[model samples]
Target: MPLGDSITGSPGCWRALLWQKLQKAGVNNTHFVGTLPAQGCGFTYDGANEGHGGYLATGIVSNNQLPGWLNQTHPDIVMMHLGTNDVWNNISPDKITTAFSTLIDQMRVSKSTMRILVAQIIPMAPSNCADCGNRVIALNKAIAAWAPTKNTTSSPITVVDCWTGFSATSDTIDGVHPNNSGNTKMANSWYQPLVDNIEALS
Candidate 1:
């Protein structure tokens, strides 16, 4: 499941690149499963994903919805790139982290062995949300620190850093969402960790 916000759903978005890359690499057994389906990168690609535009982490968790989705999809892996909206909305760091942690716990309940790849959200145009960049940095740091502690002999959580070398000015459509180049970068970010963990899917 390519899970997140608009970044995961937009046409030709990172999720599309992820599908294209996987197909090119000949990984066929895997399917992009989600409760919601969206079209991006034209009609040539699988458009299924759990990405919801303009949804916050708190919103996703509070509705008691993720567990249902997890049970329904039964995905082997979940690629999550949330927290952009949380940071934009100026939600406190602790609350954001708590919400994220809760969501992960819910996922584990549904599929204890499921692999989850969480992302350090990409950069945003500072003008779009003041101190947004700083908040992202803080949240990513928190996420990075929090991830390793969750690792175990089984069902380890991996953190994919999507911020490094990512240029918001050049990569994003409005400093909040990725443009084509940004999408390609995002795709590559998702691909490496996925390939490294391919054994888990089998």
Candidate 2:
């Protein structure tokens, strides 16, 4: 299961590329989940998407509702591609990490066996927003540092370095959201780690 904003949304986005890779890798009945046109962090469709385009991690998971995506899907593996919007919103890394930890904790209760893959949110082109690029890097670092110490929960953390996997050098649809080719590359980032290991990933 993939949870996120546009970076995780498919049907025409990069998610398609990742899906194609997962298919080739023998993942069956797997697909990307999201809501479109930017809803600004509402837990519609049972947590499938809180796709408000400008939302940060704090807004994505709130007290008002349980994330339906985790409850319904209860996915064994989850890819998180959020944080860019957090940059746009000027949120701090500590705050973002707290929100992620909260959401992961929630997911643990929803699906105790799930392995959560926390993507170091992709690096945008210099034009995307300086704040976002910096914040994303920080969030990724924080995730890397945090994933190991939290042994109480069942959700393991894995970081797919999307900034290195997909970047402006390989992007489509301008420097922001990746196009088809870029998506495939980004999805490819999941292959090696997913195949060889399943422990608390980083």
Q: How does model 2 fare in lDDT?
A: 0.61
Minimum summed lDDT over a 10-residue window in model 1 is located at 38-47
Candidate 2: residue pairs that collide: 40-52, 46-68, 46-69, 47-68, 158-201
Candidate 1: tens digits of C-alpha lDDT, residues 76-147: 788899988889999877788789888888878878887889998898865758799888889889888888
Residues 1-202 of candidate 2: C-alpha lDDT, one tens digit per residue = 5576666653324444444555666654443443343222222222243334445578767642336555555566666777777766677888878888888887778777667777777776546465656666777788788767653455556677777756664675656676667766766776665544333332
| Candidate 1 vs. true structure, TM-score | 0.94
Clashing residue pairs found in predicted model 1: 11-40, 11-41, 12-41
Give me the runs in candidate 1 sitting further than 4 Å from their true place. none
Worst 10 residues of 2 by lDDT: 38-47
lDDT of 1: 0.83
RMSD, every candidate, angstroms: 1.5, 5.9
Which structure among the candidates has the greatest TM-score? 1
